[model samples]
Target: MAHQVSASTLRRVLNIWPPFLFAGIRVRALSADYHHARVELRQHWYNRNFVGTHFGGSLFAMTDPFWMIMTMQALGSGYIVWDKAADIEFVKPGRGAVAAEFQLDDDVLALIRDATADGGKYLHWFATDVIDGEGDVVARIRKQVYVRRKPPRDGNG
Candidate 1:
């Protein structure tokens, strides 16, 4: 990584990011190793839809950056990671505070590395379930992440 920042610092920065801040999205916890993260969205007038429930965009936004960021951190600078696509299904009306947790397991990381070892790209799908305060699922989000091992650099600079 070009610049190394603590996981807690990253969490603070993400919490104040404009898209997240205005959407009432908060990063509740980010592990030191970036293997796990929790994010929440609180019901607010600005983030409510016409039906008086959580805005679909806000719900999706809360889970947006976690997978790609966490995967990148876990893989370090030797690999490239990108969010290729995403799909979100609204399962229920979101009220109060809804949260989503992201976890990267060792097996998944190993799979990514093995798949990308040949200098080819690997696409992995990560899932997140946004749940309400009562622990009911409010939405299901799927994110497709692309990873590839960075090619050896040619010294020219």
Candidate 2:
């Protein structure tokens, strides 16, 4: 069973999360509702590409788990969520810091809930744009998440 945690606690934990910390990605903001979040990746010597641009892998990693994590939290313990697939398009070379904002609207959440209400599985696609300091899109990330409602457990009574 997934343990419930406060957003603040999650934020703190994610800050120290190895994948993020090693990549120089920081979780800048996460809304209490889990509906909105922002992550930024700084361009350092270690994380930059040969051309001195933000590494493509780092750009993708910055936004990787947000959608699935948010969906699982919003749907509660009854549902299972996992990242099924993802694709990234490098639009432009990232010269400086790049950030991605994740937003999950109530309507989308409602749709997912209804779609998976009958122990059914649903595949949903979400997108995030990695933007540079100049506000231009550096890359676009597309993710496919799989969600399913678990079967009811039998009581020991």
Candidate 3:
């Protein structure tokens, strides 16, 4: 495609999606320049686990798209991004409203760019913590991203 997708447009598409919205996921804040965002998970039955705590799946879902999305936006065009791997440690049950923030700092971006500049794939790691309304940690998530430089579009083998 010859067009570009802005962060605001992507955010809007996600917000109105039934799965995200119905699951009580809300995007509280976003910044294009910084490539940072904040999302909140409100307490609701749809997100309740069988034991009445927050659903583990819902907790994982709330975090799935943030890092990859932010990294792609931060890195700009001519790069390939994908979620390589992820692991979550559930420290405590999420009982109420929970939130998580995603960030892409200059240092991190520099590292990614430098590593992938040679057209080699690079793995970038990021961490996020889901916090309750009282600011206590509910879960810690670790994500690994695969970044690679796109080859020139010459169509020559």
Candidate 4:
């Protein structure tokens, strides 16, 4: 069985993680079940671009890892989850704090379970929009994750 990791622990760890800390990204909220998460990035001189707007890289950084994290936690030890690929589009210049929300629904979870039951890997795509303080979308990001069931272990023990 896999060890359970709490939402608060992960939030705290990620908050201080170098990439996020340096980019001014903060994990504001994570649901106890790991089905929902909210991340925010505050614009600062260090994270601003030549035009004084939120850097595109920082905007992408704020959204990275969320989809894979959610899927891994939900699927537990029986599966292997990895971030396969990603793409981000800047919809508008982010002037201030920008945030993104991630949600894993039951239907999706069930779909994942069904897709990977054959022990073959499955690639699933998830999308999220980074919105400004006024709720206007600042960027759109799509993440593709790979998941597969673990092969049966030997009974040597």
- Models 1 onward score TM values of 0.96, 0.96, 0.92, 0.96
Per-residue lDDT of candidate 3, residues 16-82 (tens digit) = 8887888888877778663788888988887898889999877888888888888887777788889
Segments of candidate 3 deviating more than 4 angstroms? 1-3, 155-157
Models ranked on lDDT:
1, 4, 2, 3
Name every residue pair that clashes in candidate 1. none
lDDT of 2 by residue, 25-124 (tens): 9999988888989999888899988888888889999989999988888778888899999999999999888889999999999999899888889999
Better by lDDT, candidate 4 or 3: 4
Candidate 4 per-residue lDDT, tens place, 1-157, comes to 4456988999999999999999999999999888999999988899999999999999999999889988899888889899999999888899988999999998998999999999998999999999999999999999999999999898886
RMSD of 2: 1.1
lDDT (C-alpha, whole model) for all candidates? 0.93, 0.90, 0.85, 0.92
Single out the weakest 10-residue window by summed lDDT for candidate 2: 1-10
Q: After superposition, how far is residue 66 of candidate 1 from its true place, in Å?
A: 0.6
| Model 4 clashing residue pairs (backbone) | none
Q: Decide which is better by lDDT, 1 or 4.
A: 1
What are the RMSDs of all candidates, in order? 1.3, 1.1, 2.1, 1.5
Collision pairs in model 3? none
